[model samples]
Target: MATKLLTFVIFLAGVLPAADAAIDIGKVLGEHREFSLFSSLLSSTGVARATNSREAVTVLAPNNTAVVAALRGVPRGADTRALLSDVLSLHVILEYIDADKLELLAEGRSGDGTRVTTLLQANGKAQGRYAGFVHISVGEEEYDRITFTSGAIGSPWNATFEKAIAQLPPSVSVLQVSGFIFPPGVIPPQPRARQTSMPPAPSPAPGPMAHPPRQPLLPAPAPAPPRPTPATPNLTNTPPPSGNVIPIPIPSVDGGMNATLPSAAGHRVASSWGVAGLLFGLVVCLIWSL
Candidate 1:
């Protein structure tokens, strides 16, 4: 039948693109927060979880007085909940991208500027330093800040800024990127190490002029000494001289070939060393017939 209905139409075209990616993450969490927790932390610091799930997002949020003055030089307790969860996971960003994808990621990017990456991250690193510069003159709603540099030396990324205030959300706002667009030794881009892709160079084994029979190289001579040969004697007392034949050898095809035939109840089972010496001779003949 048309190859099992073309393998059930290639398994329903691979289950309709994961059922349309679970209905677009339930219509992007019921329409926007832009993947909130500052954009589901740039896809939880793994980077662009499907580019912040499309549809348009331009978060410049950082309000509760810029998240309480970006956590006033942290230090309240338990190491201020791991240094404000790595300075609020490097300020989240995966892209639902608005403000024209932050001016095409800031045109030709210059120094003291570029380093935008977030999905926040911890121990294995990367929880902040997403300051790729895009400060469009503060208020009047043109806010878009992504700045960096806060509490440095031996990295104390305020524990992703107290895990971005315990993963905010009640409608999203978080502020405090103070004095109009960051610069005091600008910080935020830490979650670094990720590179990975390199495994593709193994296809050269076909040469010998693509198979023919060319095996020639010979030049290598001299080195032959040890001589002496002449001793044959003990003929086993000269015997056996009537009807001598001895031939029987046929085995080959890589020896003992069978072409499938083993199961006669797996040759009557019993061999873990003959069933442990027949259960230790039936427990020593049941303790000598008790």
Candidate 2:
């Protein structure tokens, strides 16, 4: 009857989240020098308050050295505070799980993983829903090795379950791990580029009708203007001078006929005409004197 009663007590202890007195995970971890790093960070991130909840919890504790190693790669500064806080939350499991229970859970789950809720309800991509879910599984080569981290956020960043550090019945339990469980938001390092071979593209066929490379068109030279031809008198169509031609006076420029400048030939012709009239007048006077 005592054995049965003890079993029942143990079962109740596993079922409970945390007793009111057992909630201070910080104080418990603070007592141990090895867990001091995790303890301080838990308090800073307020994830330690998760142990004070009415729900049961399991903490996968990484030692101070392990904590330092995990954080070593992370560049230090205030910007990483929220990231560190979320990372700290990843160490915590909301459900009460002893080392033996975690071992049993590892069985039959060869391919698919199991999810464990953490203290960070707001740490994932979604709002209000719990984001930090650690994927639990047993290592293949090492049967005993249990891995805890999420596939939703997979990586070179992973935390391995080492051993159970401490256990408090009906409340909080602490397990030591090899590394820190990285959160979902942090980006991972880029993978190296791989060399690959591909067939080259075929060149365009060069032949008649194929389009040539475009060249800018120079502006066309301005057209040359037509040259002016001088006016020539039509000598073939001109009439010989008659007696009536002498009496016809040259018209004024106002009469609408354009004035033409006489050449040297015209001046010689006028002088010759005046001399012939004078000789004819003298002959007529001598005839009249006889």
Candidate 3:
């Protein structure tokens, strides 16, 4: 009877929420050091306060070796702190993402499709790995050298969840399937801008043919009055004046001088030819004289 009662109690405990159930994420993660880097980042970013009371969040985490590997060559300084803030902001989601959702999401995705704005208004991209079968949208900018990053899947939790989280580094940014844990008002991906082909320009209209100007009607010329037949003068010829000498004055040569100048081109050609012939003759004569 005691054993039966114990089994009933165990069943009840298993079914209850952490307030009603036994284990919460903080309690579970308390034991894992692989997640220490993520924890530190959460604290640094003050994200721990947000997650403190939240439940059922499945974190895709990178282990200590993974964290060290990521941070190996990173300078430990103020800059590193700023980088850490962004890295931590990237990893944690407001809610949980379960396994089934992850697989379905992975199968359907390719490339980084969109940036998911979380409840914290943190922005991250969705990336597809595993030949588009697994989606990873991690945005952890490392100030250090990336040495050993956990793969998409890892061992240890090797049995179930480890392969998924371990394969990836312990980052707050991780791949989760759809519908695991939803923060309210998770905005849908933005629509891509539509490419609109411009409409072609309209053709010009045919123009009307131009008409030639009409010829002006001119007034008929007044009929010329019949010219009076030139009167045939009576043939009484006046006798030539006797001994009248009519002298014709010669045209003055100075006033009537009409001289034509040679064309410039013609003069130039004639001058060049003359010079050339003279030169040739001089040469010939010198030869003959010698």
Candidate 4:
């Protein structure tokens, strides 16, 4: 009896751990101290809420200082509100992209300058007279040298891609970048020579381990192989040795699912109990008759 009670307790305990497996991006960003500015912008721009609400997505977030600098560079006459909103939109992608996936994409992205439209498309933010496209520069297929160079929407108006800051594994990824990936036509061509097409923007790195860094852009550590456990025997499925085992029905204990006999060991255990019950009942009848 005590052993049966112990088994049920073990099953209930497993439920709590399964709940932890879910990742909450909104809660994660809210608690992180370093994302104050970035998080604020995400809300103000509506990007944060949208991403958190979705199943999965990748975000390239600029730190507070980087965001400030990028905004500061906006020309005097341009609409600051519109530009800032667009800038914030540039940092996020609608699909989930983990570091390992990004690395693989970097190595083999159909880099034919394929343009990836961002969530910003909903905002009516477009580049040139054409639909906007963020082009991630895949330098080469090499392993260690792989990097994010720039994502360009226009001829020379390109946003620099920087290191990843934090991530929640395959579901949500965040990278710190320099400048806005959405280079709306507002940034006019420099001089008439077309001399500087996509000049590299230096990232204002805060520190190595800034803001307890949520998830560095680097690939997630490979998962450890699952450990093997000893196998147990089940009597329910095992062929009953002639009349060796008896079958009985019991309410399913699996949270309303059809009650199922335990595998090998559990089935054998139940059969033994049934056998003991029969022998005891027979002894009682015999004693009563005598």
| Candidates' C-alpha lDDT | 0.38, 0.68, 0.43, 0.58
**Could you give candidate 1's per-residue lDDT for residues 35-103 as a string of tens digits?**
244334334433334434433222344434444444444445554444444444444332344433334
lDDT of 3 at 218: 95
TM-score of 4: 0.46
lDDT tens readout by residue for model 4, 1-290: 99999999998898656542444555666665666677876776666665666565667765677566655444443455556566666556666666566665654545443344565654566554434445554544543433432254334434444666667755777766554554545542122333567878899877776466577789989999999997665546666454543344554666453433435555776778789999999999999999
TM-score of each: 0.19, 0.51, 0.33, 0.46
Candidate 3 at residue 59, lDDT? 52
lDDT value, candidate 3, whole model: 0.43
Best by TM-score: 2
Which candidate has the highest lDDT of all?
2
Worst 10 residues of 1 by lDDT: 158-167
Question: Residue 248 in model 2: shift from native, Å?
Answer: 99
**Which regions of candidate 1 deviate over 4 angstroms?**
1-30, 33-37, 42-86, 89-187, 191-203, 208-290
Per-residue lDDT, model 1, residue 60, is 41
Estimate, for each residue in 8-115, the C-alpha lDDT of model 3 and write its tens digit. 999998997654442233444555665666566667666565555444333545666655645555555675665455434334444444544544433335522222
Write down the lDDT that model 4 would get: 0.58
Which scores better on TM-score, 1 or 2? 2
